[model samples]
Target: MIRIETPLTDETVERLRAGDRVLISGVIYTARDAAHKRMVEALQRGEPPPFDLKGQIIYYVGPTPPKPGQVIGSAGPTTAIRMDKYVEPLLKLGLKGMIGKGYRSPQVKELLVKYKAVYFAAVGGVAVLLAKAIKSSEVIAYEDLGTEAIRRLIVEDFPVIVANDIYGGDIFEEGRRRFARIDL
Candidate 1:
């Protein structure tokens, strides 16, 4: 497994390949549909994003409120495609990695190469299990958006797979190709 600690550099990002298991540590931000929409809109209006996106990773999640003694609850990855339209803008601002469930569009895949970024797939059914890796989380923006608020998370050994790498590698596509025909 490749262990990546952010802020991710171009050299670090280039070394990653699709299908590698990874343990990601350091700070990652959380933003679901609503928060993403707001961020893109802010950019459209010539405003800066809520956080400094340079060399950052954004996890697509809207975590459940922490139960009494927990840092967070059920911090599963959301479907990444829903946030696709919001990606390039963030990438332009120097975002480097994304963690979520599901595959990315072809256009999005192309952009990853153009901008030197990667997409990670977090296991979908293991929300509570994943929350254990997040040492702390705090809402940093859009509190009124409730669960969809942007959160800053400090994680340790957060598990994920490199779903899409900058070289056009896609684990999901490779999986389907590997088993689809049983011919090769």
Candidate 2:
């Protein structure tokens, strides 16, 4: 398995492709629908909403409460579509990648192509397994949003699959076709 630590450089992003099995290490910021909306609004007003996203990976998630001693609670990926509205602007701002489940809208896909950004997917509903990789997590913004607040998480060998690559390859579509039973 390939390992990726963040502040994701362009060269590192170029090495990644759809279907690559990766073990991600280093820091990632978590943001979901509510936080995303706030961030987008902040961007619109030409104000910094906290956190420098350039060359960073954004994990679409809202984790549960940590079970004492744990750095974070079950932190699996959230649905990708919910964050679609925020993707393009961020992509334009040098955002290198996204980590979430399911598909993005056509416009988001278009931005992925235009900006050569990529999207990765983590296992859905597998929070326990997902949380173990998080070595640390802390709130960085949107504190009043609670769990929906933005958090910076330090991870060690977090497992993931590249769902969409910069070249427009899509694992979800390919997998569905590969596993489909066609009637003869």
Candidate 3:
């Protein structure tokens, strides 16, 4: 598995390719639909983003309330398409990585290549398991949005698969082609 940390550098991004298995560490941010909308609006208004986005990774998740001792509750990746429209603004701010489920639009895939960034897929149906990787979590913005609020997270070795890479690789498309080659 390829190991990568936050504040993803351009060199690291250049080497990543679609279908690469990854174990991510260090800091990441959370933002569901609501938080994304707010962030996009902020960018439109020329306001500063809630957090420093330089080379940062954002995970599309809306974590549940944690049990007494845990840092976060079941943290699953949401459908990435929901945040698609808000992506360019973040990308412009130097955001380099994203983790979520679902395929990205073709335009977004091109954007990844244009920005030298990557998108990853965190397996679905593994919410509880995913939460274990989160070492710490705190609401950094849009707290009023509750579960959809933006959060800053310190993660250990979080598992993910590179779904889109700066080289214009798209795992979803490759998977489809592979399946097609296998005559039923």
Best by TM-score: 3
- Rank list by TM-score: 3, 1, 2
Q: Rank the candidates by lDDT, best first.
A: 1, 3, 2
Tens digits of lDDT, candidate 1, 1-184 = 9999999999999999999999999999999999999999999999999999999999999899899999998999999999999999999999999999999999999999999999999999999999999999999999999999999999999999999999999999999988997975
Q: RMSD for each model, in Å, please?
A: 1.3, 1.4, 0.6
Which is superior by lDDT, 1 or 2? 1
Q: What is the C-alpha local distance difference test score of each model?
A: 0.96, 0.88, 0.95
Candidate 1: regions farther than 4 A off: none
Model 3 per-residue lDDT tens digits across residues 126-154:
99999999999999898999999999999
TM-score between model 3 and native:
0.98
* Candidate 3 local Cα displacement, residue 160, angstroms: 0.4
Candidate 1 clashing pairs, residues 3+ apart or interchain: none
TM-score of each: 0.98, 0.95, 0.98
lDDT of 1: 0.96
lDDT of 1 at 76: 94
> Which candidate wins on lDDT?
1
Model 3 misplacement above 4 A = none
